[model samples]
Target: MPPMLPPLARGDIEEAADACAAAPLLNCLLREVGEPTGDPGVHRLHAGGRLLRVRGERRPARPEVYADGGWHRLTHPELVKLAAEELRRHTGLSNSELPTEIIDSRDAVAALLAARARATPPAGPYLRSEQSLITGHPHHPAPKARGGGPVTGWLPYAPEAYARFPLELLGVREDTVVEEGDTTALDTFGEAPPGYRLLPAHPWQLDLVGARPEIRDAFADGRLIRLGRTAGPLWPTAAIRTLYAPEDDLFVKFSLDVRITNDIRRLWRHDLLKLRRTDAATASAFGAVPGSAAWLSDRGYRTADFAFEELAVLVRDGLREHVVPGATPLLAAALVEESFDGSPLNGLTDPSAWWTAYLRQVVPPVLDAFARHGVVIEAHLQNALVAIDADGMPVQALFRDAEGVKLLPQVTRAAGWERLVYCLIVNHLMELAALLAERHPGMDPWPAVRRELTRYDTDHGLPEIADLLTSPTVPGKTNLLLRWTGADGADARYVPLPNPLARH
Candidate 1:
């Protein structure tokens, strides 16, 4: 039997959940629509003309809005209502869905908090790190919203709750099997019938799509056959759709129809079709880099033609091969959240040295990939893994998720560079810097970042490096505004934040 979680009071759960949910919402409101009010931890919301203030940095909480000439503490629902009203006025557009999502996200956090209180985190450092994000996507309003489905539908599969389960195996008929690249790792999971090819599916995904007529019809016609679940359990990662199977030393990404953060976490056919090119380009670029930094290649994918997006399973390279020997690999995002058991950032006496070492491992590979191969890796926290040695210092950086990568000429250099800046600087480094600075007060992290960038000789080529170092504003993605305006998640629109890297 699983160990019992500590009993949590109903009121405590609600308050904790509200805080978790409100932080990201408040972050979005402040970033996209508010300006600093010259008071510490206070900003003026432009549309509502209301003064909003919150206590704490990184994860802002204890929200209060100025109204009726006095400060009023806003509940989770009130905060959502305020955000919706401000966004509607700011964008001059109405979105009923976003407001609903905001509420759902808060409720979802409540449920997760309750569940986690009773559950035990995974034993392994990597698995524990992967499941550590309770307050996901620091800037998105609905980071934990699981398609607004009931708690029963998604709670069992949530990483934050430390859930683990076996994958359902399926046999696709030889004629219906569609695959590309090195998907051979999948066959080892379970045996298929004589004439069929093995296709592993996430049970949650199967539960979501199994009832469809097309899927039912395929099963009836012997185009698809159930092969039972894998004996070994696969641990869900921070990205809910992806699972890490320790036994096989493999990572499998599935097409989850649920909207996670921004996009429906599905393996789109268009992305799958171009998976080989992108993965190969990334692999080659990392290979050319002169260091231990590695790329966890998306080896390939397998799916049935009829249920393409619904049934897609992507095979990503496991960490054992790419990670340096004697070093442990932990998700970079987990480090930002300090979610894992032995985070390097925790209890650091000299953060300056540690921050410098981190920049060395992470920054060079990204710059080299851009300069040499024109491959812009989405080096956001979730996509990055920093492996550390016995002393908990970074030795290697490994990146994954080829689907998020953009090749230079495919998107113009200008566009690709912008995306790179958002992912690398704003998403990855900035978050890490904030966490480091918060943990160790008086450590100015940006000068080390500036020094690292200065070492890169972009003088002959990319001028963006110089511009970035001296620029007043850095790109910050507007998640709340984008969702409110009903824009496609991939169609990223950035607003400018004061750049800390700029040398004054």
Candidate 2:
């Protein structure tokens, strides 16, 4: 394999997005490990760590091992040193054994593994990352009956990053496997099922997926289009569906669902459509410069289509893996569908607090993306992705799931343009303001959030976020409301986040 690879840079596209979500660790890893399986557009590396994979023989590679909250603690100091050495060794392996270039996944592995390890609890597998709870085999946490054809299961939980790599490393042939009852285990990096499910990326969706073809192309790419589990009548195909035209990903929700109230549904729906609309208008469009679907709207490309299951899949895959930290709502979800790992913020003393501050600070630049393009967006937590660096500092804010972006028709009409202020500022930003007020008191949270957004319009005439990466750092990192907690004990409702523009 190659000894060195060039640095990974969001340098152009994401650089202009927002500095808040930028991960230099991603950049560092790319320079170190070159790349790993799948995801060629980017690079990867063999970051060393005590990774623990636990899947049955049938679904061995499924991240249900790690993301199902199945993680093993890497508490031993010796294990940490070994991880680094192993990564260096892996990067030096022969190219025929494992190519050193691709989407730059190896670089992310260690950082991500470490972050997940930090999230692990001290006592049991709860915080340590365990896979024991995900399998459906008789010995699995949830045993299946012999009469089952296929268990009727939908992961109403946090999804893990696709558990496909370990299998590829083991040289498993995915085409021949993927049966309902077949199982295998792998023990290369620690523990794993030598066999598993083979749901690889569809070739046509490459533009959006960004996973490497060299590794995942075997599952179904060139084959016939395979449908997932059969759909029942109750599944709302009309609105729940999503559309993807090449680099585009769009979704919508009809007026339904018993558990969701009109307020929640309305908020959810508005954020959904508004986000897509906003991204299509701005640089949030997927797979392009200065865009992430939310940015695409600014360029004048409308949605190509829609499907409920498709949207569900998007949400599922998205939550499973993070393109940028804090961007996916799956960050807030306690339930997991698929599994994934690699969070830069995992080592923090107070991870929840860091996440809270992350959510609060992210709204600004996301709303700013709209302002840069003379557009308005529904800048809410659901609409934004929060990114924290290795040190747990909030560094980047990228928006996706376009359905949440909206251009205030009223504001646009008044100025002979779409009212970005209404959608971005009033509709979306205001709601988050309420949340910050209720969920994270103190520190002029509303103004602090607004300051970042307003700066885009006032300073650079609303520049896209990429340019902000190299730009100056804003103030406010200390929260004045440290003494205040929204609710106490296990019912604590508020988050402890530092003020983004704080002098502290």
Assess every candidate by TM-score. Answer: 0.97, 0.30
Question: What digit string (tens of lDDT, one per residue) describes model 1 on residues 269-374?
Answer: 9999999999999999999998899999999999999999999999999989888899999999988764456688777778888888899999999988998899
| Top-TM-score candidate index | 1
The reply for model 2, stretches above 4 Å from the true place, is 1-259, 263-279, 284-364, 407-447, 450-454, 461-504
Clashing residue pairs in candidate 1 are: 5-118
Candidate 1 has a TM-score of 0.97
**Model 2 worst lDDT window (10 residues):** 136-145
Q: Give the TM-score of candidate 2.
A: 0.30
Regions of model 1 farther than 4 Å from truth: 1-11, 458-461
